[model samples]
Target: MKKYILLIFLAAGITMTISCRKYPVDEKGLLITDNTTCYMSSFNLLGSDNQTVLVTIPTFANGLIDTVKGTVTATAKFGTNITKVKPYCSLGANDMLVDPFMGQWTDFTQPKTFTLISGTRKIKKVYTITVTVQQ
Candidate 1:
């Protein structure tokens, strides 16, 4: 009876170990797992000097991220040249964005849409960014 009980416990332990998906830390002390983050964490607009040209609402938050509605919004400073401003963004560490790349002169006269893909490349979300120039 004792041997049978021990065997059952071992089987349960093995099942639990196999069922769990979270991996342990690796040599670099970083948790090993398939990254699932897929969103724009931050958004900023820069001018020719490569510095932010958007007016801060409270000294921070270059733009607002509305995850529910998948929208990003910001207000550019008065007299800013929105026609040739460049956009900078912070996304998931391993994520990749191409085709209308950042840091290039882009006209923000109208709203722009950006598609962000997860590091795992299994999830994607599109965010529409609208910048209004302050008068």
Candidate 2:
């Protein structure tokens, strides 16, 4: 008799705990998961033709994407106009930049900050891009 009572109480406790779990849902009732990875893998400036505008004469000049410092630095070609250049980058599958909209003309003569974010958790990372014209 005592064993039966203990068994019933244990089953009830298990069911109550199991039914109490709740997962976050989006507006459409879809489950929201955390994917906390928001960083730029590659960063580059492009010209009107969608090609890199950095100098590559004597040596290739690729933009530095410093994940540690969260900064991007590049040197444009000698004749390239920094005021009318575009930027391209590589990000994680679930990471996207939220500020300073991408795929548009941006003046890079001065340092600019671009904020990247991850899905669900909205983890953000700011990257400063500084471009200088090669003399």
Candidate 3:
């Protein structure tokens, strides 16, 4: 019957179309995959401790980070970054808070978020960065 022939043709067409679909690939020709391991790696106060506190992203996705863990001086500027790997870098809304950079003000306590994006792939990882300080 024509109905049966049309059904078979439709199924073949769908299969061929799906088989030709392509995913974003990296420079190496490997397909890019979703990654959820974005997190803050370290935090430090400028002109002061020079001693850096290591931070971890909780196992839970999009987990909150309590970076200072305690109060810091009013005049503290901070530097921070995520663990480095090729093609991926962290970015923050505030220019000073960008990854691998410094110069953020510590006068008020608030939460900031960083987006981890791949340089050679279309993937994103999001994380929240928070610092606690005394009023």
Candidate 4:
């Protein structure tokens, strides 16, 4: 009976340790990856009235084998008019890319920034961003 209890205790301890493991973050507090794309989206940005706007940004990778590069592409639709837009990357407080135009995807190689402008005043608005990491 004592041997069985000891084994059960050992298994429980191991399970707890595994479940509580944490990943290491980079200096910027962002998760780090090797040779992989990372995607990040933002919560909807709502306006005063209640009109909703959706924005999406997709990043692409095309280069020589073993070489990786990133490009930002975005589309914004307000109510009904769909507009293709591009946001400029800007430095953020955490050194992360802050592209309001759309979602952002980046590799571990370098940091990026992005900024966007809404053409009109929206009473109610929401933005959806998607980032895809290509391997």
lDDT (Cα, tens digit) per residue for candidate 4, span 29-123: 75432222222222222223333332432322221111122233333354422222222222112223333433322221222333321211111
Off by over 4 Å in 2: 1-32, 56-63
- Higher-TM-score candidate among 1 and 4? 1
Winning model by lDDT: 1
Please, what are the lDDT tens digits per residue for candidate 1 over residues 31-117?
Answer: 545677876777889999878888753112443787657788889999899999988887756544422577889999999988876
Per-residue lDDT of 1-135 in model 2, one digit per residue for the tens? Answer: 999999999999999999987767656575556677777877678888778898631111243667767787778888888899888777764434446677789998789998886656467788887888988
- Write candidate 3's Cα lDDT for 1-135 as tens digits: 999999999999999999998767755565554442333443333322333322332222232333333111122223432221111122322111233223443322354444544433343444454443322
lDDT of 1 at 124: 69
User: Candidate 4: misplaced stretches above 4 Å?
Assistant: 33-35, 38-135
Residue 6 of model 1: what lDDT? Answer: 100
**Where does candidate 1 have its weakest 10-residue lDDT segment?**
55-64
Predicted structure 1: lDDT? 0.76
